[model samples]
Target chain A: MSQADLSIPFRRRAGRAMEDAFLQEALTIATTKFIGLRREAFDAFPEGEGLRDRAREIKEATLQHLDRYLEQLIGNVERFGGRVHFATTAAEARAVILEIGRRAGARMAVKSKSMATEEIHLNEALEEAGIVPVETDLGEYIIQLAHERPSHIIAPAIHKTKGQIADLFGKELKRTVPADPEALTQLARGELREKFLQADLGITGANFAVADTGTVVLVTNEGNGRMVTSLPRVHVAVMGVEKVVPSMSDLMVFLAILAKSATGQKLSVYTTLVQGPRRAGELEGPEEFHLVLLDNGRVDQLAGPLREALYCLRCGACLNVCPVYRQIGGHAYGHTYPGPIGILLTAMLNGPASVKELAHASSLCGACADACPVRIDIPRMLIELRRQVDEKRIAPWIERVVFESFGWLLARPLLYGLAGRIARVLQRPFVRDGAIRSLPLFGDWTRTRDLPAVASRTFRERWNELERETPR
Target chain B: MTTRAEFMARIRAELGKTRGLPPATPARRPARPRVEAEAIRAELAERWPEALERFRHELEKVGGVFYRVATLAEVVPVVAGIARERAARRLVSWHAAELGGDLGPALTAQGLEPVAMPPGEVASAAERQRLRELVAAAELGLTGVDLAIAETGTLVLSSGAGRPRSTSLLPPYHIALFDRTALVESLAQAGVFLELWHADGAPGPRGAVISFITGPSRTADIELTLTRGVHGPKEVHAIFVEAPIRG
Candidate 1:
């Protein structure tokens, strides 16, 4: 589901995803493989633990003085003959890029995988303005052809099967290809190569921008980042303000652990460091370079509850390990980002009310925190978000009433015991197998899960009886 | 549109509201990057054989072909043999100034058509376009490595006056030549060299990009089935010359 399609409600979307057999198998295989790969990658590298801490420290440090680092980044980018633009909102970001494309007379823009651009829905705007935006990454290309959002961060089309992608390729290219991955990949390579050569504008998202050197770093496995930054006459990099690092030293710390967390590779196949526009004596590279610094709610989070989330590297490790994400998949989240971190990011970008339902999506398992390279304490922030949602009265009235009544009852000993006794008698008809499988007024809660029947005896009651029976 | 002043002001406001954040500092940068880089070089001088062995093993693990040769002259035969095996003849290479030594004549003598990129920027756009097309059509790309990271088996190549970014990128097969001089034990040590390159008043590569290539371009996007050469070279062969090519 698209961001605009959230009207369907997250619960129904999740239910639909759970019922899809193909998606179920796909999510299991894909997330399980990624979890194993990430584990193995870290297992082989003993020092990864220290580096993850260092990486976390660097992210926090940069955020503490984000203003200073951003200024340095802007100065150096301009010093290197690149232009810097400030965008405070997604629409503003889209406008800034659209104006750049307009001025450059760009007919086609080739883009690498970028959640920032995706968040802004840049492709639709570009197409509306008559500039063709081509997604160069194979997964992104497949999704773009299908008019779908990325279901996974690193593997955009993880929800897709080879047969489905072969069909996508066949539809887009007007030729049928086998369902083999290698054949499909070769066909996409041939298709995107032409776009790389012929496109007038190259757009990308910076994995990290070095403040001292004014370099925008892009790490990709398929080399599309390099192609996007190198091929076209005009290049624009849209990046969140949090992506800037203090120096090259800090960047290497992230580089050491980022790929390990995402994939098992020690480093991605290509780590392209783009300083600025092409220099005078260079034969290739864009002549004009532009870096768009995107705020779009990230600035508010410095003092907001989701501040630690700013340290997110956009690695999908959290998604792979998330129980909700593994079961329901990304589309159920109904936003640009999906999964545990995606919930916080969605809240960060859209606000607390946006994730009224998504906030309760997690089981608070803490696997995401362990898998997170930066250790952002996702569950802590998630609970915080849930509180904010409740405070704002954004939760459904039924949920608010139930939780508030429960809180009220728990605050008074006599009332709590009385309510428990009443609940035990009322829960008899719905009780089966020692659990409440359905309820007259709480079907929403029992639809996908079971509520433990008020135990045969309350814990407080049990404790009191045992004390009375014992000799004192 | 948010102006720079407004953007910075808002950031400063949010930063002002932040309370009791953990005390954390970024990674310590080298005080004198050039000095630290030289120290790393001297340290690696004795440890380079071990570093080289680790590099070879890691590179081969990533599906990259690793070869060790005595000098730059031997690089041509290896390139020719790779070409013969694939039935490829057309090759593109960096200029001799950037590559450390000329291999075009030797490669040509071995029945390969070698195109050396312009030593500096071409003044005419048409000529630049022609060069891009030439590199795109070439079957092989040959360039010299600026740094060979042993820990990750990565080849670091910076674009500059004589080094075009497309030489290693546009071709199907990439063969990079490096020596003991370019070997760095780990990414941390490579960081020192990178710091030196960007240090105040330091002379760095003139071009706009530096690429760290670990293996050929790969993806597991479709069915999570790993595929190589999705957009970049399919095969990467690194030739390690015992004698430093610059000398």
Candidate 2:
């Protein structure tokens, strides 16, 4: 949780990833394939952009009246014969889940990919209670076996190579496994299948909680989540309070945008909605269904400009497309959520003061916001967080002085222009191939890209020259 | 209880309501219009022929076999074939009249029993429990795609009558028949289709879960290895049912 511990070192991770030629090849190949496939999915339609706009609008409307829908959701859940509990913190959320596990006398939990639970560290808490929790997402399950945290928001183990995966299987699953992605998936299925059958509890995250019918919509490519909810006698869904939308009409927007942005598909392979426990008329749902709605700093976000953070669908396309996330992978972020979204989420949830170090993780290049389907101005938010960090005086003295100097100079055009000319002249020593090379102050920025040289003639100088020649 | 708005007002008052952030200011517009939908689609189609080809290619990539049949009548024999191959006896199915008349009679003739039940009439835990047992025991779970996205070779079905939401899930093997005409290449088109059908109510899909299933249920739970059918339907049969050739 400390700042030093939290620096994502995305550039460093990316540098290492680049060095591992095999991994670089895998990542490039996979990312390229998926991005193209995603584009194709959108291309098949004439109204893709409009669909996204509609979806985003739906999402906004849904979240605007979220509280009302949450109430309706509670009412519907109760009416449908489900139990809903509200939690104010990670401890409370964990307590509710563990209590459910205890009451079920559950020894193991099979979990779907739910960032809310990860934010609460549900697995560690459950393990402390002497119950093992298994992650069933292909990416999550792989990382779980390695005892590592998720790397990307969606593609958790995107940084891992096929060989690393094959080795993990060979050693842990005790069989020769191929480097094939298919073989890897089959291995996970074989292993989780038994757990699904034996586990006493199913813990999942809700993608969207529809208030109209009290349905918990869970979308997954793998079937593990469905089993986690249905097979287990006790099903516990841990979701953020913001996850609930008011109606099915509102739910459509998220459903449309979520998978498209996340996996670049029309939809994932599986989307299941559970209304409540095995209704009197239903056959296969959990006997007891419990929903734990965690506030855990989201309420604070709702009150400020940072509320856009809540609108994040966790699609992870932002991270996939983010230059920063591509480099560090997910683990170096040192939080449950990773990438641009993870930085903001961890900062808000862990108490922004504690995560001031993460405030500078991104370049204000605007790609994260650009890739964001919900249109969250991520860079602007990061800038705001940076400002807060400085105001709180938690930012290091050196950084404070740098931005302060820049700010003061920018306030006076004359001073700024003079400084700019001076800096261009001073850059001779660092210039390599017309770009800065190995500058002492900020080497990371120059490490990959050539910092383009400032034009020889400043705009002011040219403007003055033109004025002198004009008749006026 | 106080009036609904009054109740909310009281909570806000008790909580010490204060003015919050100003509404989001609109950004300055770029001179050129952002590309329109048709243009984007045409660009996508032109620039991404290989990708478009791959989209359909990948559908067959992940253990999903999609058929491109012309008519709904062709649906019956395909359903019957799947049932016969699975050697299914008690079939738990959704309410698709097309399937019942076209496929059900064929299934019955083939000695494959098809029981199409109304969704959610199981009034007690015992009945519900029995239904769950049937899902696990049944040979094949049959249902119709509310809409299918060709770009990903996905089947979209929400729970309703005959589709005992549980029947589509929880089964070992599931065979879904979709129309090729139903296939839209992009999520944008998929969105429009959903919008068009938005108000056409089917129990409001209360607990209405829109499932966009691309292939059979799969997992990689053990050691970062892949396996199919961990929780939901293990084997999925997607019959694309392509539109019939014009004479």
Candidate 3:
């Protein structure tokens, strides 16, 4: 419940979010608006199918040949008067950026929105090192001020209402702040603008990293990408290895989908492509540029059926349209990345050893894959991960025992019949109005939906009577 | 990390490990010789004129102006009138025949000084402070759109000659010009425009992105309340040069 123990499974922590009515309403409103906007943004367009297809092809091909592209990208970025760092894990990434922060003498950092930072807990790292990491995006800035982590990907503060934000800011600043979206935005803007002016380093994330041109593309509705990339003396972009594309041409395919997929705009209000820090003649760019490319578990995913999962553009379109995600919301997923995409991402990044239960959270309905812009087979990946966990003996003994009993019943007809008869007898205690009202060992399910009662006559007994009634 | 070759070899080994990718079913290919771009352009042009008008109306709703001009000859005289009307001093426009040496001489002769904007100066705070110096000292900013969208009635600009991203962002007043063909049905069509710009057929990766300006630089950033031209151009002028595309 405290910051000291934040690594608990989503199931345990999600209850707190589920209990907050304001968070529920805020999430519902924000997601509904986003889903509608995305639908209206790309619905029945000629370019929709072509854009998605091209994006998918580009991602799959990049994952297949990722190392070659990454090397070329790194070389070209270095050639363009920029530095490239390869970090294989979150710790490595944080350490690399922290070192950059130290080298740049960054007392303060102004950043655009980055999910990777949330995954790595970069703010905590910066704060520990006596560096202030200021989030420039309005939503992120509000949440940072409140000392909370992002509940959603694109819009991190999607779960909090204006009233909650006002209350938090009021308490923190020792002054009353109005609970209006307009007023709250203005107050945060006034507060963060000073940080941007004083920042020594600007941190950002890449929407697409073009290898051929050694360009990092950032698409944002707010001008934060530009401010973060250009204003500060040193600019550091932390990107996952999967964010790379082969060429500028390949970058075009993603640029087509990311805007409409994320916010349903023709393009983000601002899309800045940083070729290599500051060129000699360029007047308004960082003096030095550092790109930290993190691998972590992406290389492992690239060689398998799960490679398609790497094709994600972080459009959040999949999350927007998912039925289960819509019902349970992003906070319920409990991982830094939540929803169907989160399920695969958390398992992959957390490794199978740490998360044996997160894999089972999926409904296996294939909705996530259906809604995926790059078409990651999420349900398939979930199933594969479950298999890997079983094979590696990472699954809990109770799960193994339950499934063993399932196999036991299937292999023995007499035992299966006897079990059915006993279940019917046992149903009497719990049955209320022909539905099982209360059952042990199954509260999470029965609490929400009614459990159907077992039929009175066994199929075998009915079959035997029918055989007797017939001319046998 | 690992050697790039070892990384690639792992892929080859994986390919060998699995059955070869499922055989792709053969399908008939479209029997088209080439894209008839001229025909498409002409059809687009016809629909785009009305689309431009509709777009102009939309931009107007968001506090923008739509001007219809016939000739480059009229453009200089009109800009001079705007300067005289606003008591302007300095003006910034894109590097085109529409606002070039030919027109520069005419504007000077008409008692108006023309200034070309430096590229990519918008991102610099120091440059911004300097531009604020220039913008406060000056009266008007003029630039050409990189492209325009018909569906949204938006203008797309990038970092290029005459159209400095900073000039558009720093100046209080901006005037942008485009042809009717700049109009697309919607943002989806605009994506195709961008993809085509990066396509092998078109020039590749023109710096940054296609910045679509539906109206003036407006933001709901200040307390989620609508404020115009806080960081960019306060007022915008969208001119539809309703004439045939000169080759």
Candidate 4:
């Protein structure tokens, strides 16, 4: 996201998305379709539930022994003649990759759809250094051409219409193009095919790095992942530390569930596992392979509060099921990642202060948890983040005061009853249609949603009346 | 730059703080993968007809074309027919040794330009570049499947001496030849084969990549409109030969 977009408060950004007629319809259709697809996928696969649990366990197990696994991964990668680079921060990651580009004399780099690379903001740095970074995935290519960040995790261009895409392509290629997906895709394929063959550097993100065999796995519906890794002279894979798995067996468990959760496929069209650079007899593959192990903020979360968030598969399922995301879409979240999980990730990456407003973005419906293939318990962590935000004084004074006073009143029955009566007396001016349309200093809440007027008769009053009327 | 030592130390520090958490272990791998794999192969040898039926159903479900032939020689006509339908004249294929036989001459006889990749690395970079251009320009790519997953109708191809990755990738149409030998019932069984392949150590003289291709490349990114042939083959064809090509 750009600094200008980030400057807008979350509420205004969300309001803008809500008011856009096209985006509203697109979100409804896309999320509704994704929800149905995911449901059908899991409903047919009876073992999906058990596999979810096992996948979660595998993630936990891997994290528990992360040091050892990473060590083994590093050793084996070297054994396979692949270099391993460590990046403590995003800057270091970009610097390492830029140095590699400089050494390789790379004029251009072809990149597959990799959130890791996006998270690190690698493209801007590469461009500044005079190396062209080409996003090869169809969705990513469209967004890259428009100079926009991805709005969705897997479907980066879901927010865009065919007409908009036609315009973008026409502008870039300087030719009139039709508003048809097939024609647009073919045009992109033709444009990127030459870049694939000509690029000197190929960059990707590992979906899972097998520790035992020293392999980096990439899952994509498009074949950009294959093209990037195979054709370029140098291939660089940027991956978070949490992406490593123990063995090939563990990888299968994930493969079965990942696509089912993301796009409801049994498996994506391509699951490419590249171990290292081209072998001696291999006709085509990168000659030099580099794996960059990134820690930016993931290392702190190993023992931190956001630990379970590490198990996220980047499937975008939570986004589909999230009420907030469905209404406002990914852009409102104002971060690299956007969804229920994106809030926690934003908190993890930027700090608790950054997500003070974002933490309250969820309605605590827990749909994200239920839809999660690994069941990350997103709501539970969200509540924790909210508490941390308040405790750290990141929340506004009014919110803290209101919540604290409510907690105090609820703990004392007499005070709660007294307060309810006082509130009913004070709410007469704003209470219409048995709901509060607006309230002094709380109009923000009532602006979009109605607050139920303190009941005409409190539940306690109704209980007392029932007791009195019952026969002895 | 973050040195390996400092990075490991930071990870250790955080890991040290995590204690008394719930116990968990990774998925259990097959204890003796080689033995287990052989047992699976033997079991599949008997039930291959059912597996093949399921594979065909699933493959077609994902927009793949399937063919059944009585013998390896019968696959030639099917390939020619596919080429004729698509008007694809140029083809690149794995080496004769890797493909189990040389179909190049027969394919050429059918009025198609067919080239086979060298079995080993080319001695010169210029020659390698030339072969890459050949694969890139060719409309049809032919290779052999290392494993054909019945559960998802996926064809697993491991890159190696004769099998250049682009033979199935760069071309617009990918046709893979396999028999009961490569058929596996599920991804779990495929896992066993993978474990067995890498059990002792690295396999001898192989490429550095293995691709599990479920179908042709597709995307629904633009307005959620599904489109095929984004960057990989637009059409994938799998030919099942009843008689083993190796025999």
Give all candidates' CA lDDT scores. Answer: 0.93, 0.68, 0.67, 0.93
2 versus 4: better DockQ goes to? 4
lDDT of 2: 0.68
Candidate 4, which segments miss by more than 4 Å at Cα?
A1-4, A468-472, B203-205
Q: Across residues A1-472, which tens digit of lDDT does each residue of candidate 4 receive?
A: 2222878898898888888888889889999999999999999999999999999999999999999999988988988899999999999999999999999999999999999999999999999999999999998999998888888898887788899999999999999999999999999999999999999999999999999889999999999999999999999999999999999999999999999999999999999999889998898899899999999899999999999999998999999999999999888888999999999988888889999999999999999999999999999999999989999999999888888988998999998999999998999999899999988787788899899999989999999999999988
Which residue pairs of candidate 4 clash? none
**Looking at model 4, how many pairs of residues clash?**
0
Better of 3 and 4 by lDDT: 4
Q: In angstroms, give how far residue B220 of model 4 lies from its true place.
A: 0.9
Stretches > 4 Å off in candidate 1: A1-4, A469-472, B201-203
* Global Cα lDDT for candidate 3: 0.67
Single out the weakest 10-residue window by summed lDDT for candidate 1 chain A. A1-10
Tens digit of lDDT per residue, candidate 3, span A277-391? 6554344457788888876676666656566677777878777666656655676666678777877777668786545766776678876676666777888888888888888
Spell out the clash pairs found in candidate 1. none
Cα-based TM-score, every candidate: 0.98, 0.78, 0.81, 0.98
lDDT of 3 by residue, B142-224 (tens): 76665566555567775543344445544557777666555565554554454445444232233333355656544443223
Best candidate according to DockQ: 4
Interface RMSD of each: 1.0, 6.8, 6.0, 1.0
